[model samples]
Target chain A: MWGVATGPLRRRAVAQNLSTTLGCPVLLLLAQGYDRPSYVDVALVLALLGPIGTLVFARLLAEDLDEDPPRAQALTWAAAGFAAAVVLAVCVATEPGRAMVKLLVTGALLIGGNLVASRALARGMPTAEERHG
Target chain B: MDDALIAVALLLVAATATAAVATRDPVHQALVLSLLGVALALLFTVLQAPDVALSQLAVGSALTPLLLLLSVRKVWRRRQRQGRTE
Candidate 1:
């Protein structure tokens, strides 16, 4: 059997995925008006990956699993909530088409990265016996 | 801009924070943090700043919780083992 892996990388991936999904879009939308390219990149890297960075540190402090999937399910709901919020955003969005496009791309990256990272963490978590024995 | 969805999203903010604080379990608290994360994402939207909202959505709501959960799970297992060993 494969050993359960734990460390900063997976945790980083999780936080990166989470913040990217939830925070990056807002920053991206704001950055769109700016002429400087640096703003956009910084926004993307920081806001998008901030949560992942936080998670990496957090993972080091705690354990990796429990029998409950309620938390996991709640995460899914949060994702849906984010999507619903986006829809609300679009409904209220000002005309010009550019913001919409930016919003869509940002949403895709955040949600996509998040899904991939979560799966990786799930697969990598080690059992208790593996940890102690 | 059905106002209702916006209101719902606004309402979620309190829910998320409450969830985060209401738990004794670190894992559950982490999960609730994600809800707060989504609420933060929604706040970005309402503020007309989708860029911030997008990043928050990607990282805060999704990744943070999972990582925290992963860590919390590990800690939980460790505690359980200690309990068993004792």
Candidate 2:
């Protein structure tokens, strides 16, 4: 496994992925303690927006990251796997129903979005000069 | 137990906020600011305000940083262009 590098953009990407994934456990904790089904929406929104946020950075900071495009393949996949595992655990804990389906959808979005964002970061967006030229 | 979690979240918010301010570089400060947003969301969630946390996640985790980074990029590009013209 390649060690995670220390570039600023790379670190930013990693932090974004980890924070988004962290929401799953927080959701589970809230569900366990509180009887509120609405809290799940927090995780859902996070799963939805987290990657888009990263992509924003990837696109806007392309020039800065072009020199050291993040390449944390192992870490990104590990975080995605962790998210999938959490979603599965939550699914098993909850009775199968709309909530389970929602959880599954959120999990799919979280994993898929993070993967796409990471790939974009690794690939690096085209610089303005390159785009115009 | 819940108190401990809240305390931890509060600590995170303080630490990240302080770091965001202390960092000199706008780009790095934006990074810290995003982390601060995540911390604040966690604090709000612990305080049993998921709605607030949701909005915080939306704005803090991504949008604020995006705006900050965009501004920094624009300024840097303008400076570069000015340097070329001069």
Candidate 3:
């Protein structure tokens, strides 16, 4: 969090994306450790919205990051995979049922959104014409 | 075990909140604030209030940052226009 708050724009954005991705596992852990299935819903909503917040930064700060974009492919993959593994382990513990299905959905959304957000952060937006006009 | 987890979450929220306030830049503060929101939501969940966590995640993680960034962009644009006019 400090990294995101103190670094330059590029590092700040990357750190923001990384924070959202990493949040998935912590949410899952909280759900499991507390023995509350409803807690997973919070994780689900977070997974869905974290990327949207990153996209907001990417769109708004396009000019600032145009000179030098940040790319951390390995880190991005690691975070996504961590979310997947944690979700899978929990699903196994949960067994096959409605709750497991929800877990699977959350896992997919978390990884997919994480990938999309990191990719957007790495690849600067196209020219204004293509994006807006 | 859950006690330890809750303690860690409380620490994370505290640290992230401190970082958010410590940062000078509005943009960086927004980023840290977003993360702090997540940590706060997790803390709420650990405390057995997923409903509140859900609302926090909705507002803190995405909406707050979106609003802050949009306003920041608008202010920057206004400043640039003013500079050009001057």
True contacts kept of each: 0.02, 0.36, 0.83
Evaluated on chain B only, what is the TM-score of candidate 1?
0.70
Give the CAPRI rating of model 3.
medium
How well does candidate 2 match the true structure, expressed as C-alpha RMSD?
A: 3.8
Clashing pairs in 3: none
lDDT of 1 by residue, B1-86 (tens): 44765676677676656655655666445544654665676565565565776677567644666666667668877999999999
Best by TM-score: 3
Better of 1 and 3 by DockQ: 3
Question: Among all windows of ten consecutive residues in candidate 1 chain B, which has the lowest summed lDDT?
Answer: B26-35
- Tens-place lDDT per residue, model 2, A1-133, is 0111124657766676566666656665576567676777888887787787778777877767778877778877888888888788888888988998888888899889888888888878765687885
Candidate order, TM-score descending: 3, 2, 1
lDDT of 3 by residue, A73-132 (tens): 898888888888899888877868889888999999899998998888888788767886
True lDDT of residue A122, candidate 1: 52
State each candidate's clash count. 57, 0, 0
| Candidate RMSDs in order | 10.1, 3.8, 2.1
Per-residue lDDT value at A107 in model 1: 57
Off by over 4 Å in 2: A1-7, A126-133
lDDT of 2: 0.75
